[model samples]
Target: MGVIQLPSPPRILCFSFHILLILLQQTTAERELKFVVVVFRHGDRTPIVNFPTDLHKETEWPQGFGQLTKIGMQQLFELGQYTKERYSNFLNRTYSRQEFYLQSTDYDRTIMSALSYLSGLFPPSSSQIWNPGLLWQPIPVHILQKSSKQKLHFPLRDCPRFDELQNETQTSPEFQNRIQPYMDFLQTMAVNTGLELNHLKMLDNFQLWNTYDTLHCEDIHNYTLPVWATKDVINKMEKLAELSLLSLFGLYRREEKSRLQGGVLLNTILNSIKQAANSSKQGKMEVYSAHDTTIGALQIALNIFNGKLPPYAACQFFELYQESSGRYSIEMHYRNDSSKDPYVLTLPGCTSSCPLEKFAELVSPVITENWSKECGKQDKMKDIFLGFDVAVGLLCIFNLVLLYLLYHYGRCRRRNNYQDI
Candidate 1:
């Protein structure tokens, strides 16, 4: 044993140092939530449309189809109250226009939902009251017309590339694989439900969902259920309907579709966060009152969709935080159920308190600077422009050649006439 000196304790020392580094990261000081962004679906409402077999007609509902009911108002009010309580410390006791911005789709249901939510969020105190009879104060809720509602809503059907993506998703192996198992069931349901089997195959779950939701709502309100509308049957329909929705926004090239639709909203949200983070002023919240598609699109973009129709008044929260060390982070939570706490969500590759820069980096792929350009529409337009320029150039050259030929013939005719004279 020639001088076999005991190995130095470097390896053990290195292990101890590595463990301490992890411990330090784990025990970093807590961060405070600085700003909040809430995107929620409008509360429960009558079905948007009724099936032929549906006993529950749109006329039965007080406000007709798709309008927010009293129950819907209550749901949003409760959500607002809950929000008020949760951010009591963060928000000013009275509403400030500067501190909050509320926006909704142009639809009546969405606009009313925002108003309902505001009622619970900031009930006017004595001095703030414009009218003593009403506890509410008017808060501006912005909207974009149906023709221009792309940024706030989901499944923006205007983009041809998105339509192409949906077609591709339908034919994709994953979509085919997932739906194959349910084809027989869907066919049977279509027959009973009076929906065309082919149409069922090309499922628009959101549309199908209206039928089931109407029947379910009727049953809940003590209306007699149809013979085929048992609880189990409704549950099955609801599941399949959800699958249809999933298929629409999920599977092959989901990211690309998201970039066109949901990612637009995400880009807006991130831009808002960046603006808030960079600016010295701060706000308590921003609420985007929209539809179930809005929630689904956002959840899909965030990769945290629960794979079901988000219930009425479902709220998705994006909370911004400032750490003790002056670093900012983002946290997300989803409140689909009133009885339970909002589900805490972490970004795919980040911790609960994800740093703002890291959050942006993680979501960069989904966001787009130019929606039309990224959707391939702008490129198509560019190609059309080039083709149009070439066509115009050829037309101009042909006109010049025709003019030269005419001029030459006239000159020869005039020269012959002059020689004869």
Candidate 2:
């Protein structure tokens, strides 16, 4: 090598050094994770509502109906622990007002899940330990007071336009086409399960999911399943339920439906991201402990729904990173199964790490700025009614004028004839 090595050319060495410098700069730019938004479905829980024929009753659960179970708490705790490990470098070692925020839907399971998750995420340290006996410390899990206007969750009720959109979705060709294949099975299920097929909307996928969940949970606990609860039946029900879910927030009038259901949450997330970009007052990480419906709706809005129902404790992550070039990008990852690594999700028109500006532009179509005003429920009906009333009034006036003219002409003719006689 020494005999073959003539001194390297000065220009070549300088060019190589310049290339190395540029790469170092690029590596530095990729180091920072500026913000994070983690949205997770609440962990395993007792069925919210069970079928009438089910053997399991509300009394069997210690917290009664729709409450989080010990298993759910443990699931969330594990999720929080995983989150802590992933963000150990980005997030502060111990919880602080500036470093973390947690929110949950206004329900017993979701609120409790948020609290349980917090317990694992921020185990008290020596400096902040209020009670030496316990490793947990109180962390705020905020919730909006339940009202007619609940904007934080998906499938929000009390929105007249949302209900109208849902009705429209149900009647769309897509919905009909999807349901046609399942009609006979659903009809039989209805008769056998004491539901009315004519009132199918009342027993939509969410309701079917309740029945399936009760059975699944019972089976897990060694409770006997009915003869009809075969694997094929369960899988079919699951598929149809997934389709019904898609119709609720996707298909046909997807954008409008998203505006009414998932878009509100999207807007919240966007605003949080924007705020995080500009301000330090807000926390670096925002966590939402919500329901499967919430996750499904959000995924549908994002156009990343994988057609299967999100499992218990499934998580979706939105991470904001700043590159060495001083530009920010947003990366999305979905963790639907605990056993597998989270899947990296790219926006349709962008890469896995989509620039912040580009990400916002792509998502703008689904973000409803003012949800109520955008809904515009009564305006169309009012316009149609007003037009109808004006048309009727014009018709009445024309008829009246025609009758007067005819009467006048008849009188004139009669007078002329009498004068001639």
Candidates in order, TM-scores: namely 0.87, 0.82
Query: Which pairs of residues have clashing backbones in candidate 1?
Result: none
Q: lDDT tens string, model 2, 193-215? A: 66566655433446666666777
The ten-residue window of minimal lDDT in model 1 covers 203-212
Predicted candidate 1 versus true structure: per-residue lDDT over 1-421, tens digit per residue: 5987764699878888999998777655455677899999998776678777777767677878878888999999999999999999888889998899998998889999999999999999968999988888988998977778456777786687787778787788988887798788777778777887776777653546666777766765676777877678888778877877677776667677778878889988988898888886856688899998898888788777889899899999999888878889999999999999999989899998799999999988888788876666657677899999999999999999999999999999999999999
Candidate with top TM-score is 1
List the global CA lDDT of all models. Answer: 0.83, 0.82
Which number leads on lDDT? 1
C-alpha displacement of 397 in model 2, angstroms?
A: 25
Worst 10 residues of 2 by lDDT: 196-205
Give me candidate 2's TM-score against the actual structure: 0.82
- Model 1: what TM-score? 0.87
